[model samples]
Target: MNVPVHVLKGAGGKAAEQMAAMGIETVKDLLFYFPFRYEDFSIRRLEEVQHEERVTLQGTVHSLPELRFFGKKKSRLTVRVLVDGFLVQAIFFNQPFLKRQIELGQHLIFHGKFDKHRLMIQGAIVKNAQSDGAFEPVYPLKGDVKLVSLRKWISQAYKDYGDEIEELLPESLLESYKLIPRAEACYFLHFPQDMAKFKQAKRRMVYEELLMFQLKMQYFRKQTRESTDGKEKSWPAEKVNSFVEALPFPLTAAQSRVLEEILKDLNSPYRMNRLLQGDVGSGKTVIAAIALYAAVNAGYQGALMVPTEILAEQHSASLKELFAGYPVTIGHLSGSSKVKERRETLEKLASGEIDIIIGTHALIQEGVDFHQLGLVITDEQHRFGVAQRRVLREKGIRPDVLFMTATPIPRTLAITAFGDMDVSTIDEMPKGRKPVETYWAKPDTLPRVLKFIDKQVSMGHQAYVICPLIEESDKLDVQNAIDLHRQIQEVLPHLHTGLMHGRLHSDEKEEVMKEFAENKVQILVSTTVVEVGVNVPNATAMVIYDANRFGLSQLHQLRGRVGRGSDQAYCILLADPKSDSGKERMAIMTETNDGFELSQRDLELRGPGDFFGVKQSGLPQMKVADIVEDFRTLEVARQDAAKLVASEAFWKSEIYAPLRQALEEEGVFRKERID
Candidate 1:
């Protein structure tokens, strides 16, 4: 991990200090930050050159043409440099330094793009001709970073300190996976001798990183398991069934299956750690409500923790209605409640008066206590870290945990991120929740869309117009929420309109949300901060401005804010019509309403960065792990690692001792205890 300060300096001078700002401290970090792309310097045959491509061809030197300037300022210098075998025009606008770099009759390795008329254009790579040019990895470079110099520097680094790199993974896992040597992975990652080793190296690194992450997760799950009493509340499943039957809508098969899985955990002595994956309008709350009912029936209180006070209040209100006739008093605890009210709620919770409590992080605060908490449910599961959830669990009597999320994660990411939990997905939306109608439009079409919203508002319906920008910014010319709020006010002057963005105070935000929920506001203009933990049943429309700026999962979440009620939801994705990417995004939105597929698309488009960003538990630190590129390796590693770690045999193995110590390390990813 120690990068010589000299490598960045080129000659080991003050230049080294500049690259440090980018968080590039070590050679290892620099090496691992592989090229986002590569410019192939290997010779391309010119006669068969294709248009709009990077090509290299070897032939006798064609005549070097004139370096011309076409601009009025005469500053635009265009250099047409001929390759060894072919004639091509290299057009550079005001690029004088490029002319100095090019030479005649040198047999130069010319690397650039060619258009239909053999015009070499745009940003392309060129190099000195070499007799033997291996697969050159053009790393993401700085002042003097290219395929050639970077390789030389990295070769120097390995030549000096390659032996010093400690093999981090266990020997058995490494051998069993047929992984490349750790040093080899590092070496080829920077300058791969061939593509086969390059691919293999990527696999090894991905597997190594995922394995470490999986092991850390297993450690935490195991550590938490030790403290639990292996106690399960023996409540009649029939009561839950009665509650389900009593509901107005029938439970989907997915709901029924997930509930059975939950009941099995409740019946068993083993403490449960389960994830409930429900889509946008899926009925995760009902299953949680049934679990709460069971806990109360067994004479023990339960708590449901959501990420936001707004959602907590929403859950509390719903549960109160659901458990109306049942012998249970529900308590709502949140920062929004008055001090005296919070105290009253906490005291009732400490006593036997409250059967179920729902709130945000306020429920886990110092003064709040639960007399006998038997079950705990967390909505939007990724919002809270393992430590935060563990603190909430400590509030209960070894409460069995049920984590629920709307983000339809691919199973691999779910297992990787929440490996400790046995996942249960209520994949089907409740029978009647209509799949939202989706559309992609431009700002120019706003008159028609606003008219459409006006019609809906006139018909006594509500809509959410989401803006990308929060406020009027000097830097960005895009529409801001406050400005848009004012503009929308002009169109729908008589109707109730509300603005909700992250900049608003918590109280103001809550008030606006309350107003929206009560149908006080016919239209709510907002930012993406509304992505998490908002529930409005009456609102049937979601209009996202600059829809291309959002990821698919985030857009889905925003769309989920509406469609909670029986209303047919409409998710209108509004963006500038110019971008092809924007068009593609809108198409994804209009396509099948499957979270799994959307998540996969998201991963493909943006890589696994979205998963880490949402998880917010700290990024999985697999030095070699890339869930996208080397997913197969990661899967294999996960299977092997899970089998070993879950087994008693793992503890007895010679490698297990160090592996356990690795898990115990301060920053090594498991159950990190911060004072």
Candidate 2:
């Protein structure tokens, strides 16, 4: 099983290199590399054949192969075959080399779509009729690797090392779940006898993959819970309550509840690994502020890490304003901080003078040190990587970690991606805030939309006209910021219009955002760069051009830019969607303002990969299990894995030896940790 793939038959030279490119380095990798799809080659009679139906036919060649050249090294190979007493033309494209293998009166099997009107088969492939299986496994190929070579090599590997593949799941689990054995699964997955057996094989593999992933999550959760170095900080009820009471507005019930949960985690002996999720303008910042104040009141310094410098500055300003009249000292740090200011801030931070420091990725740099750092809060938590968060947390001795995201993650993703952490959501809006009213319109209504924006701006409120692209693309017939900005200015030349996109320098973007926030730019036309970290309370009207080009979460986030203030806000989606999904997205946006519900809908529309970016969240890329499609199965696997991890049998019993060894090999559990 440990043998190199290069040593396998027909895989010695460039084929080995290509297989390595496909991530097949060892015999084990080859065996476990499952097929993406299977083609049914079950024999079908002419009487049962339907037009354009994919069918496999066995025949004897009635005529010699004729090869003809076409455009750019392409060729057409055709032969007349006798199938079920009828003469049919079999055609293959770009396989002129097969003419050498074809002969008169040779028996052949062809698999492709049948055209009854033409009495022909658009042959995808032609093989010797001696092939055994009723189904063909099609593997994902890369480089110059062909499907035939992969099938041949995988078959060789299975024949050589099939029984050596060890079963990772315990015997009790196998019996309870009725899962097929590991070797049998590998066989069926690579070579299926029938659809029923193939499905069974796939189920076992999917469950196994999800189970292992959950076990790793539960193990880390167990480690985090079992750690003894967590700081059991004192919750100064008097100071916290005083600060809360001093606020201008009362905390919403949801905010109060989430704050209470955080305070409880802070007071407990266990480390707080909690996720704070709320919709845009849902007052999550205030909850984080209260938590930071509590951390300071406990005589420990705190840190707030954001994704961008602008957000860092915004957080610092908001936090400082909230902590006014208190003894807490707030410091701001970023990559753009002046040399002298940074030096002083670092010195103060090290000497325990700054109670709370707000910064971007600069907070996790090597030179930055925390003075008794007891609380670590990361805003827009998904924007940061696991290692970055870990480095910030490692600055202190088991500091309680609070992660905040304005993008409301669908519950399925929250459980599968952040399964190891506790989650708290603030679904309710504050007292006087109004929900942004959304509308969808056709391109012909653009004149009316512009008139509306002009009216809003005249009424002392600003507006944002969002475009999907920065420059007009010949490929996509959508509006771009540059041209849209020019056109908007041409239409309403009197309004002070500002343009901001991702291409602008950080300082330039900041300047544009500043001008917009200060109401100097009444109408800001830009791209999706303003989809996050831009808070403009006075901007009451948002016009999204080509709104169908964006995802639901993104459209929701853009709409959130407005309606932050007490004034009623309106969002107009200018879209002429041609597809059902695009129309559905626009309809969903106008239907409700609940981010959570929209997120669930978004998950169904666009799978987990595109929902808030799956890769950026550091989620394990599974081979078989889909967190979206297989959410119920994921829930079951999570529960079962948690049960197993909680029991001593998983670590001690001989029956679980294979499971432990498998996990250990994956680095899910180290030997020393288990011991």
Candidate 1 Cα misplacement greater than 4 A, ranges: 1-40, 45-77, 81-107, 112-121, 137-187, 219-230, 385-387, 611-617, 646-650, 653-675
| 71: Cα error in model 1, Å | 15
Across 45-127, the per-residue lDDT of candidate 2 in tens digits comes to: 98799999888888899999899998879899999999999999999999988999989998888889999999899855885
lDDT of 1 by residue, 1-675 (tens): 475547543725444554454345677555555544444556766656688876654433344434556666453434455654346655555556656765565455555577747456544444556645556665555664345655665677677667776676678767776888878887777767777888887777776667777776666666655545757688776887788899977889998899889988887777888888878777888888887887778778888899988888778888888888877898888888997887788789888798888888887789888788899888887788777888998887778888888888876677666676678987776666688888887777877888889888787789999988988889865788998899899977988889999889999999999898888988999998778878777788888887887888888888888777777878888887787666776788898677778887887877666654844644454445566766676677667777877898777866667666656664644446320
Clashing pairs in 1: 3-27, 44-56, 44-57, 59-84, 59-85, 205-624, 206-624, 206-625, 209-622, 230-269
Q: CA lDDT of 653 in candidate 2?
A: 92
Q: Count the backbone clashes (under 3 Å) in each candidate.
A: 10, 0
Which residue pairs clash in candidate 2? none
Total backbone clashes of candidate 1, pairs 3 or more residues apart or in separate chains: 10
